[model samples]
Target: MLSALLVTGLAACATQATAPAVPGDTALGPVLVDAKRMTLYTFDRDNAMPGKSVCNGPCATNWPPLVANAGDMAKGDWTIITRDDGSKQWAYKGKPLYGWVKDTKPGETTGDGFLNGAWHVAKP
Candidate 1:
């Protein structure tokens, strides 16, 4: 009986030890962070250049690309990119946009400067 109680207590402690959910930022809407999955997203597509994006495919699976809803009204510098698949993705310029897999919080910018000359933080 005592062993069972100890095990239950340990399980409860482990559950309570999990990291808290990342909060939303004023500039960014809702940022999702999955450390195990390694992904990050911004409220807007700020990292995109006039016509380029650094993410795609398998990279996209780790850092899922931010997609735009049809009829989704434009806000700020956000624009749309019609992919070959005919799906609309969000863009800053002509460049497509994406998130990173290492960022684990809304305010956390871990993905910033990743891959040396590749990944960059989405600017607002």
Candidate 2:
């Protein structure tokens, strides 16, 4: 368990490189986008637990988290957060990032203002 704790500590503090994702043009302006240019989003509920993602299970199914690869690290305004499942997800300025399944095309902000305005496009 000590090693696990150490790894967790490191993951929380270590930061490196540009994020795996990039900014893409959306009607919402420049929002964080995946390689496919699918618009990313942030959930207000996630604000409850700073740096943690609350959208899991079915919630995650609808809003897929912007998952970080094994070697991924936090950098600049981008920070790597540990999800409940122990998986790494990317967060910008402390808010977790996600993709909307409802968005079938790139630059789509259909997920914005979703869920009673709880969701909004992840901005740069």
What's the alpha carbon RMSD for model 1?
11.8
CA lDDT, every model vs. true structure: 0.51, 0.88
Which candidate gets the maximum TM-score versus the true structure? 2
Model 1 CA lDDT for position 85: 57
lDDT for model 2: 0.88
Give the clashing residue pairs of candidate 1, or none.
38-101, 39-101, 40-100, 50-94, 51-95, 52-95
Model 1 lDDT tens row, 1-124:
9999999988766544443222244233444333333334432233443444445557666655666665554444556666545666766534455666555544666665555536654443
TM-scores, in order shown? 0.51, 0.84
lDDT measured at residue 107 in model 1 versus the true structure, 0 to 100: 63
lDDT of 2 by residue, 1-124 (tens): 9999999877655533556678899877898898788999999999988989999999999999999988776778888899889989988899999999999999789999998999999888
lDDT of 1: 0.51
Candidate 1 shows a clash count of 6
* Candidate 1: stretches off by over 4 Å: 1-54
